[model samples]
Target: MSTPQPQTHQQAAPAPNWQSAPGTSYTSPIPVTRTHLGHALTSEWTKIKSVRSTMWTLGVFLLLVVGIGLLVAAQTNDNDYADVPYTIPAFFGLILGQICLITLGVLVVSSEYGTGMIRTTFTASPQRHRVLTAKLLIFFVVAFVVSALAIGFVGLVTSGMHGGASDNEWGGTVLKGALYVSLLGVLALAVGSMLRHSAGAITAMLGLVLVPAILPAFLMMSESLRTVGDKMMDYNAPNALAKIFEIDSENGGGTSQLVLLIGVTAAAIAGAYVLLERRDV
Candidate 1:
């Protein structure tokens, strides 16, 4: 007391929970795993199958393909199928039904862009190319399977209805036609990804499928351009499918059209990848 004892203060110790422990690691409650193409594929599959647009488009497609096919089969005499493959009737339905596929293809990616869902998609995945690849894989497989089934159904019905008139070699033609339609859907998907606009891409694809076949008729008025128009008609999508179905076509053959479509689809896919990488999400 006489010394007026020097004041001694005790500092508050930091809480154990707040202190960082050396060499200690923290693990989150949520499990972490690396993402891959499989995850992306599952996500895309869920998206495509769950959407209303997919159901509506595919429903109309099946209706057109199967209904018109049956109608065509009913009207034709069994003897008429001798000259043409029984699968030839599938062309009428497929050509019109193809519009549904093109719409769906554009919607697959473009709808995401339109709705701003692409931001969430890119944010979650971070790899644009992988996302696009998954989309392509999922879309192409679905398109191919659905088209094959519809075409196969029509082929079976046509063959059964016109049993005596069916050619033995119609199998290859039916398979080829289905493949061609699926490829067109893939092409539409690539176009959708590249353009990223639904209406614009749909219009472009419609023109791609229809213009070459229709423009030639108008070009006949021009003496010089008539040959060019004729060439366009020969190489059009309808003529390509007609060639596959063994229908009367001035087109060279399905092989050339298949090769051309493959090349163009490849180029478009490459372009989409490059553009996706360069552009901001």
Candidate 2:
């Protein structure tokens, strides 16, 4: 008061700048990398390979395919295979082995849902379709390759065992069986995605693969339906695989079963995509 107090002023605090780094031009401490389908593929590959179920199921598949194939080959003399292709024995084992593939396929997707990991997956990627595509690609490739190798091994062993009866033409049949089984696995995956429950999807797929074959036997009462039933059995998974092994089915073969399988798988996959898009994780 005595001497006019010096004017006092307080500087305002600097406004926060969250968009940029503190005291620097950098935006963030973490490096940002664009994600693509390849990244998703790698993630799927890691998940499928890392799971215990995958190992167990695939192990059982190999044992069934190779063990039964070798046992059948050993029990039968070379002369016994005179009318049978060297790869026909593989069908017996593969028929059982297909269950393993189906189980694995269902687990591939359904397990995530069951354990609530699917939420994390979607949260991390946000692009659900890409994740599904990656799973499909990696699973199909692995299933196909492993199936092919197992079938080829059985074929080679049986061929050696029945050297005189082995048909060079059997190569195509072996390849066809591998493709068919791989397709079945893919179909199971699609079903799993649609169901989002392990037991439910597995049960549905088991019925899909097996019930058609069994129902035809009970449909013998109706002559009119018998023909249709026969077609169902003939086109069923086991019979189709048998046909590929050069075992004859009532339906004359010109890739009709293959075409049917491809069609069904395509439809299921389309449905899976549509459902995935509309559903919440």
Candidate 3:
């Protein structure tokens, strides 16, 4: 009987490492992967598409650009110059569309901070430059697509008025306009990153782009200052960048203006990056 009892006993198999001990809890770290910019871009794309503001903003831009262009084209008399670029009237809505694009781009970064999601993003990405570059990539893609849509729509709508559907130029002027608008979008992201406040950044951007534009309208007294302001408006600041879109202009010939505007854009971006790198998010 003792021999039989000894023979009946057998060893049990080991429990899996995944299994918890009796009366103990089991926890696992989230399977996080270290991602490069492409992943970050994909993530950002998801976030952008998930938000309603993006869709609404683009929708409004499309409507205003195409709608105003059609209206202007239809209302035109024969006196309009034949030298005018096929999509010239589209410029009427461009300034407005760009303003919206800049605001939206700024919010893409600033709003994340405002909502405390930036911390989560940084934590997930861990690489600062990667994060910034990813954001830049995502923003550029969106801007390019939106710009193309706006220009294409305006060209198509205005084409009908300019000599049927085939007359659209789609040349240097349209390309320059798209580039200028896209750069503004990038500039917005940079500004927002540095400022970290929407109202302040938007206000500053408006001042940078708008105040100089309206200076003549508001300050009509000083002749010397007026002369200077006229020069400033004509070809010495960001407004000169607009000249690139002017079909009538010979090629944004104001070298000083282009140089100064470019320098400012570079400085703004660099300043923003420095601040972002140094400051606490």
Question: Quick one: best TM-score, which candidate?
Answer: 1
Q: Write the per-residue lDDT of candidate 3 for residues 169-261, one digit (tens) a residue.
A: 456556666666676777788888888988888887777777777776545567658776666567523455446545436445334455555
- Candidate number that wins on lDDT, 1 or 3: 1
Model 2, backbone clash pairs (residues 3+ apart or across chains), number? 0
Best-matching candidate per lDDT: 2
Candidate numbers, best lDDT first, in rank order: 2, 1, 3
lDDT digits (tens) for residues 7-64 of candidate 2: 9899999998677556767557899999999999999999999989999999999999
Lowest summed lDDT window (length 10), candidate 2: 246-255
Per-residue CA lDDT of model 1 for 6-118, tens digit only, reads 99999998767855689887779999999999999999999999999999999999999899998998898888887777777788999898889889988999999999999
Count of backbone clashes for each model?
0, 0, 0
**Best first by TM-score, ranked:** 1, 2, 3
lDDT of 3: 0.71
Q: Where does candidate 3 have its weakest 10-residue lDDT segment?
A: 247-256
Residue-level lDDT for 138 in candidate 1: 94
Give the per-residue Cα lDDT of candidate 1 at 219: 92
lDDT of 1 at 90: 81
What is the C-alpha local distance difference test score of each model? 0.87, 0.88, 0.71
What TM-score, over all chains together, does every model reach?
Answer: 0.90, 0.89, 0.79
In model 2, what are the clashing residue pairs, if there are any? none
lDDT of 1: 0.87
